[model samples]
Target: MQYLHAAISETLRLYPPDTKACRVDDIMPDGTEYSPERWLEYGTCRQENPFRFPVFHAGPRMCLGKDMAYVQMKSIAASVIERFEMNVVAKDTCPGICPR
Candidate 1:
């Protein structure tokens, strides 16, 4: 479970799906407006690629597969790293994929 969590954490650290999420619909009794701008700015900082953030599909209807996704990714990554110490053979500055 720890390994799984680690893998998911790493993936999320890199490719966060939503990147940023905001309350599109106001559900508050006070009709408070959710400033998407604020969330975007916060998300940008939180979006420290190669680092983790808190925008893991937050809200009342967030993703339920969050844990599962993390576990699966971790297991696969752990297995690969355990057996091999691989390196990328990129020829250009942009290796196409993020150099994670």
Candidate 2:
């Protein structure tokens, strides 16, 4: 559960929802890298500073459904992981849209 939360946090950090609305500069040492362990401390998801990681916005203007959104995301992710096996088909190639 902690790892899952950490993974989600890392994902949001790299690709925030409000990328266009707000510009958040990556401050972490390996900010551009996908690292779930960065969010975890002593095997738990550390509470992030809203100002630094404003995925749900910060302070009073923050989103009200933030907690609910996390719950829904985790639930769906868990369900999918439990039911299916995911594999990387191509290691070196970048995936691109193919026109039909």
Candidate 3:
């Protein structure tokens, strides 16, 4: 179960369902340039979604299924791996080229 949780976490880290997020310019600080382009960073995770594009619903109206999604992914993946010995069909292929 521990390993299953770890694997599921890793999967989500690598391939997040919603790629990026965005927020509006709520506070336009003085003496700073306010560009709409600057709204990129808030929605993206530093390592995961570096591009800061709109993959998930941005702003206060975000995805309500965040927790549910995580739970389902972990449960389904753990069950499958625990029940059977599964392996990738093309063993020689690099995971970088495919969905890890």
Candidate 4:
């Protein structure tokens, strides 16, 4: 379960929905690398600081459904993984963010 959560976090970090830069120095070590292990410590997922990993926004304006969203994502991901075998057709191709 923790690995699943970490994978999701890594996925989000690699491909954030909104690319709006906040002026903060890159606090993430090896920010460009996709490493789920960074979120794990002693076989558990570590809670990230919202300001550093603001996928759900932060502070007073943080998304109210953040917990529910994680639950839903984990459920869906588990269900899909259990029912199907997925394969990346283009392993050599890397995804790039398009500017709006």
Candidate 5:
């Protein structure tokens, strides 16, 4: 469960919903890269200032339901994953029927 959250956070860290929206009060540009490990060391999802990863927007222009949205997303992902199993297919394998 923890790793799932970290993976999602890392995804957002690299590709934020809004990549460019100007600055609100001089933010340090040090979080442009994806680092899932950060979530283990620090609860960036629950802690830290929102400015560090403002995917929902910034300052007064930010989304009011941001927190709720995350909760809903996680819930849906967990439920879906629990209901289904995902597998990795080898690149060399043929997916279609091999008629002899």
Candidate 6:
């Protein structure tokens, strides 16, 4: 389910839990597509600059439940997938629109 995890992460990135971020810096150029791999990057991760993602806040204001939140999300996703089968319809697929 590595692909599934990546897809879910990409969804979160494209539609972040917090949409009203006041960016402190723009390491990524404007309009860049959401990429799950970028989340795995060291030093350059968005969490490095809390203002880039205010959902968990940053610095002294960082959320103590951030890690637990992720754990809960993953657990729920895994539980749901385990109990239910999900399928993507071909009609919903867009070809060549996303970089591979």
Best by TM-score: 2
Q: Summarize candidate 2's per-residue lDDT along 1-100 as a digit string, tens digits.
A: 8889989988987787773643765476655678788887767678799999889989999999999989998999998898987788888674332223
lDDT per residue for candidate 3 within 9-87, as digits (tens), equals 4454335566353476434355334223222233321222323532344557656775587578777876776898677
> What TM-score fits each model?
0.37, 0.71, 0.34, 0.69, 0.53, 0.49
Number of backbone collisions per candidate: 0, 0, 1, 0, 0, 0
Tell me how far the alpha carbon of residue 84 in candidate 6 is from the true structure, in angstroms, after superposition: 4.6
In TM-score terms, candidate 4 sits at 0.69
Q: Pairs clashing in candidate 6?
A: none
The Cα RMSD in angstroms, rounded to one decimal, for candidate 2 relative to the true structure is 10.8
Error of 6 at 41 (Å): 4.6
By the TM-score metric, which is better: model 1 or model 5? 5
Each prediction's whole-model lDDT (CA): 0.48, 0.81, 0.47, 0.82, 0.66, 0.60
Off by over 4 Å in 5: 19-34, 42-46, 85-100
Best by lDDT: 4
Candidate 2 local distance difference test against the native? 0.81
lDDT of 2 at 40: 76
Return the clash pairs for model 5, or none. Answer: none
The candidate, 3 or 5, that scores higher on TM-score is 5
Task: Tell me the tens digit of each residue's lDDT in model 1 across 15-86.
Answer: 456645456943567564433232133223122232225545555656688667656666787788789877
Tens-digit lDDT string for candidate 6 (30-91): 67676665554332223335667565777898889977776777788888878977776796
Q: After superposition, how far is residue 41 of candidate 2 from its true place, in Å?
A: 0.6
Off by over 4 Å in 6: 1-9, 19-34, 41-47, 84-100
Candidate 3 wrong stretches, greater than 4 Å: 1-55, 85-100
